[model samples]
Target chain A: MDRFRVAAVVTLRRSIADVQGTTVEQALHALGFRAIENVRIGKYVEMEIRAASAEEAHRHAEQACQRLLANPVIEDYQILAVTPAVAKEVP
Target chain B: MKFGIVVFPGSNCDWDVYWAVRAGLGEEAEFLWHKEESIPGDIDCVVLPGGFSYGDYLRSGAIARFAPIMGAVARFARAGGLVLGICNGFQILCEAGLLPGAFLRNRQLRFVCRSVFVRVERSDTPFTNLLQPGAVLRLPVAHGEGNYYAEPSVLRELERRGQILFRYCDAAGQLTEDANPNGSVANIAGVLSPEGNVLGMMPHPERACETLLGGTDGLTVFESLQRHCTMAVATSAVL
Candidate 1:
């Protein structure tokens, strides 16, 4: 088994209003950065798992996103990146 | 009828609901820990109370929905047992897919804590049976993520099914933008499942049950549940 690190990104759907994101956008506008048009804030989750392969790790990560990490009602989720963790070199 | 109040780790309103059910309403009630894998078979009603369950981690009620006790709660609801979710509990219900919609941050980007008026949209459900249609109730709400949102189609279906139990309204019982404390769509404050057995609402009825607390309107909701349970038992006995 190889150790894999995975990150899940979750964000509210476009149709749903994001009050926090909008607040942040307004704050930025107050700072004179008016060029920002669409700024949406979301959640980023990271975890490590032992899996046989990267594909297996990705599958497990997706399942976690579906079951607990993200709510499908008003948000969408994606497995950002899955890579094998490298072991430290012996001194 | 026995009422079971599910107690998540961060749940602060479990005891409040217990007290309301036992001393206030003089009904049998007990606290069920979140780790428990089973609910008492004799429990006719289950309540998911308010508070930051799991500290509202990963969004409100997002983590609490995965608690072991929720499995039993889901089973109970499937069996047509009455289930009520208030405040954070309502978010948990939505996260668990027992109800539709998700709670977003308040439109004002602030945590609102105050008493608000809500109108009984439908008096036919077990939760609102004691209330008259269009009756206005003053209930206290405390939460940041109480802005309820859903797809247009789902909202239409909810309306068509008469599932909306309560809506925020003015003192005169008019639904207006000013009356919406959290900017909930259609000023919705509470909703019942299609079956009318499960209810989820942001208002804290348990907090409003005592006259000493300046409001006794909340008691009517519990009284309605009691009445419904008694009739249900009686009908089953005859069957």
Candidate 2:
């Protein structure tokens, strides 16, 4: 089986309520990170996918994230990477 | 005595814990926000309620472990105070290093909601004193990341110490894979700390506390704690 590492960076959907994000932005301002405004928080997920093709791996990762990782109603996400990047590459 | 339930964003079960502790245990349980700097004083027990804490982002309970209140929870638990975690709270306890193991997506890769049977493995812990070994209780569980994972040596230690509190069981109280909704190691559905005061279980005992809510099997859990506290009070009075 072909395998790929799917990493998802999920953030809140623009329309939904994210009380945590607002609180964080206020805290950052207090810390004097004024330039880092409008900070929205999300999660970075890295998992190995076993599939016959990279495309299938991407689809699997997408399903996993949508069904469990991110709630569809208030959250939206785009697949970040389904490729196994070099170990030294830092994103 | 006062008890506190830590609240997080998207925590759907904070009220459930409140009802269970207040009505079922008859204790004065209060709500604690995630941003709180310290726990309320003279707390007899601390509860970490289940829900999508940190919205279940960055793994089920990963980010919530870094919440401000958790630092206080850890300090209190380490000082021999009682701690209980349910579902996502269980995940957070593991993430916070108050308990061991990690909860992952169900191997079936679907959210599972069902009534499950759990066999009592030990009754020595304060949380399980009301039940006997091998007793079975039916409880409802609903979650996506319920699969529990831990390394071999640690699993062995938990086993040796009787820390494994509950195991998924068959209808006849036999441990079976079919009963384990998630692929938890050794079918472990709950666990306790070395001191027996800290408990983390995926099943929502609080949800089953009242017959009107469908079942009362959860009462034993809180009753066990109440009994222990009552005995302690009497002993102190005599002293």
Candidate 3:
């Protein structure tokens, strides 16, 4: 078995308005970064799972995104990465 | 009528609803813990009151939807029982797939806590049966994520089926932009399930039940439910 580190990103669908994102963009523009546009904010979630294979870990992470991490009606989620955890070196 | 109020981990309005039904309305009411697997058989109505359940983790109502009691709540709703979800409870119902649409952060990105007027769009549902057609009721809404949204097609269906029950409006019942406290689409404030047995709304009718609480306009909602239940019992007795 391997311990896999998984990272997921959840964002509101493009069709839905992101009030926080818009507010931040306005603040950025006020600070002189006028070129910034379409600033949408989202959530990043990271977790560790013990699975037999990287593929199994990815599947589990995807299921978690579907069932709990994101609401399909207004949000979308992506499994950013599924990599095996590294062991620490002994002192 | 007997009302079962589900108490989720962070539920703060359970007692409010319990008091509204028991002490205010003079009816039988009880609290059902989130961990309970089944609802008591004699319960005629079930209420999911407002509060930051599961601390609004991940998203409002996201984690609370999976509670053990929710399975029974879903079953109870499907079996044609009366179920009402208020405020955070509305979020939980949408997350649980018992209601359509999802909430977004209030368009202004602020938590709004104040009384607003909502015009009743339909008077046929169990929740609004006591109200006159096109009645405007003053209710208090307190929430940060009450901006209701849905796909365009779903929105059309909700309108076509007359499932929309309430809309934010002015004192004279005009759907003005200023009247919409949270920027909900089409100024919607509440809705009914396609089957018409379940209702979800972002406002807290429970909080407005007593005159001392500011107004008693909210009592009609509870009164309507009791009227519906009483009529049902009478009809069944004759049958």
Candidate 4:
């Protein structure tokens, strides 16, 4: 079986307020970064899975997000990447 | 009446709920470990107390909702058993889908800990049957993510169905913006499930149930539950 590395991003839905993101945006403005606006914050989760194909790995990652990683009531999640894991090099 | 207080890995208020029910309110109460598969048959009510269950990981209560005992809790709730979730317990209830709506980080981005006045929106539910309509209660709410949120349509439904139990208010029972400690929608502090058997609130009623803790206004909540259970038993016997 091939090992795939998966990464996902979970963010609050647009309809809900992102207080942490708003706080960070305000701090950035205070730091003189005027161009930054609507800076939303979210969680980045990464993991490795053993699956036959990238499609299988993606499906597992999606299911994980749906069941555990992301709460659908207020947050949205996206599978960022599902790349095959490379073998480690011997020292 | 017997009460079961579920204890998750990070549950810190299990004993507080125990004391509120066992000592403060004079009821039989016990702790049910999160790993337990089922609740005892004699438990008349289940309480999810306030605390950082599972260390508030992955958005508060998100992880604790999957605890082994939660399956039984959900079944019990579905069977029309009474369930009261306080603070983090409220978050867990929402995450577990036992209740509608979700919590957002406090609008001020701070963990607010103090006594806040909440106006009783309705007194017919099991949680507040002893209280008067629009009664103002002083309860302590300590949490960082108590800002309750729901879709506008859901909020309308909650209002239409009289599911809203408490709303943050001023000492004089006014729904002023300043009285809202966490910017919850419509200043809501508590709500009831569609079946009216499950209740979730952001405030810590157990913490305020004793005079030494500063007020006894919260005692009425527990007392109301006892009264409701007693009345139900009497009615069932008559039937």
Candidate 5:
């Protein structure tokens, strides 16, 4: 089995109101940085999985996001990256 | 009419529900640990009480919904067994797909803990059968994430099916924004499954079951379960 590092990025759906993001945007505006627009905050989850290939690891990550990592009703999730991990030599 | 309270790792209100059922209401009740795979055969109603399960780490009730006992709870609920989820339990129900909608962080991002007024939007479900439609109830709500949200179509369907059980409102039963403790959509405080056997609410019914604690409006909720469970057993026996 290949060891793969996967990242699952989750964010609130566009239709859903991002109350926390709005507050953060207000704070940024008060700091005199007005260039930010639609400044939304989301979750970034990373983990290592045992799979045969990066494709399989991506599928596993997606399944985890669908089942538990992110709630689909109001949030969207995507497998951001998947890379095979290097094996370490035993001392 | 036996009641089972599902106790997760971080469940602090299991005893509250236990005392409310056995001592306050004089009913038979037991604790169902989260690790238990199946509920006892004679258990008539199951309650998922309030508190931070898994430290409310990822989200309220998200991880607890995967507890071993939940599979059995889902099976029981599908077979028409009564299930009630209060506060964090309510969040778990939604995450488990036993109920609709998701609870977001409170609008003000504050952990609100206090008593609030709610109006019974529907009295036909097992949770509110003893209440009258439009009746006002005073219950305590304590949580950091209680803003309920659902798709527009789902909200419309719930409205059409009379699944909305309770809503925050004024003492006069008016739905006003100022009276909404958590900015829930349409001021909704509680909802019932389409079959009406599963109910979830952010307010603490177990906390308000006795007059000495505060008000007894929540007593009707427990009393309603007793009435429904007893009648179901009697009806099955007669059949």
Candidate 6:
């Protein structure tokens, strides 16, 4: 299987109010650092998968999101391929 | 019987849950979205189906826990209504504080999807009234942040109250890491409230409702609820 890179980018839904983010925002204001606004916490994850082809890797990665990673309700995800690491010489 | 399936924006299992309920208990089911202020009138039970709600952004079900509809579900749960949360739904219940503990990311920090063995821990809860304790059932679990965590006191309390309903197990029904797919604190797979009215599990029962698709072990969850609720109503009528 060819090696592929996958990342599951998870985000807080825009519709739901984020109390955690709000508290952080409040804490920021209290500290008097007002430049940063609307801090949204999200998960930017990267992983490597061994697949026979890029399409195969993408299919499994999509299934991963559908079954587990990304919540269909409020999260969106995009799968991509990063340049593969060079194969080391076999001993 | 009328069933309520809550639909959140990122809830991927909403449709699958609807079909499972209909297939198990017949039609007369309605979907209540996360933004709604109330559950539809006289709904028999509520289901919080799985998926990455709000994209599992901050944490799985962390943001979805505060949805307007959850308030209604909270009220319904307090009134002793049957509620089951699968996967992300399970995470939501924990985040909402309707159930104890929380789900952290997998220790390995990877998404896991596979059929695993679940040993029914207690048959007393409304969610598991039909199964015998120690019964082993194979079910599908797909998740990234399914590691169950809680304060020591809460863990003891959960143990004391028989709130831990399902536990991950191996083919031999032995509790082992082989069964612990996500490194959950106690090999915990599901939990229930003191009243047994609310249940939350990372495994997807709806996905297991059909044998043709793969497995039907999940059907027992809904069947048990139906049986228990029907009996509860019958006994109440007699009184």
Top-DockQ structure, candidate number: 3
Arranged by lDDT, best first? 3, 4, 5, 1, 2, 6
Clashing pairs in 5: none
lDDT (tens digit, per residue) of candidate 5 on A29-87: 99998998898889999999999888999988888998999998989988888988876
Tell me the whole-model lDDT of each prediction, alpha carbons only: 0.91, 0.83, 0.94, 0.94, 0.91, 0.82
Off by over 4 Å in 3: A87-91
DockQ of each candidate, alpha-carbon based: 0.78, 0.03, 0.88, 0.78, 0.80, 0.02
Candidate 3, residues B97-136: lDDT per residue as tens digits? 9999999999988899999999999888899999987899
Cα lDDT tens digits, model 2, B1-239, are 66788899978888998998888878888899999978777777888988998777667777888789999999989888889899999988987778887765676757999889999998877787899999999999999988877767888999999889999999799988888998887999998988888999999999999989889888898888877777777999999
Worst 10 residues of 1 chain A by lDDT: A81-90
Candidate 6 wrongly placed segments (more than 4 Å): A1-91
> How would you encode candidate 4's per-residue C-alpha lDDT over B1-239 as one tens digit per residue?
99999999888889989998988999999899999999999999999988999899888999999999999999999999999999999999999999999999999989999999999998889999999998999999999999999999999999999999999999999999999999899999998999899999999999988888899999999999999999999999999
Steric clash pairs (candidate 2): none
Report residue B66 deviation for candidate 1 (angstroms). 1.6
What's the CA error at residue B60 for candidate 6, in Å?
1.1
Candidate 5 wrong stretches, greater than 4 Å: A88-91, B237-239
Per-residue lDDT of B76-136 in model 1, one digit per residue for the tens? 9999989999999999999998999988899898899999999998888888777889999
Put down candidate 6 lDDT per residue, B63-110, tens digits, no spaces. 898899999999999988889899999999987889988765676657
Task: Provide candidate 2's TM-score on chain A.
Answer: 0.78
Which TM-score does chain B of candidate 3 obtain? 0.99
Docking class of 2: incorrect
Tens-digit lDDT track for model 6 on A1-91? 5787776676656653444566778899899989978876566768777787777777887887665566544456666554354555799
Model 6's DockQ score: 0.02
What's chain A's TM-score in each predicted model? Answer: 0.89, 0.78, 0.90, 0.92, 0.91, 0.67
lDDT value, candidate 6, whole model: 0.82
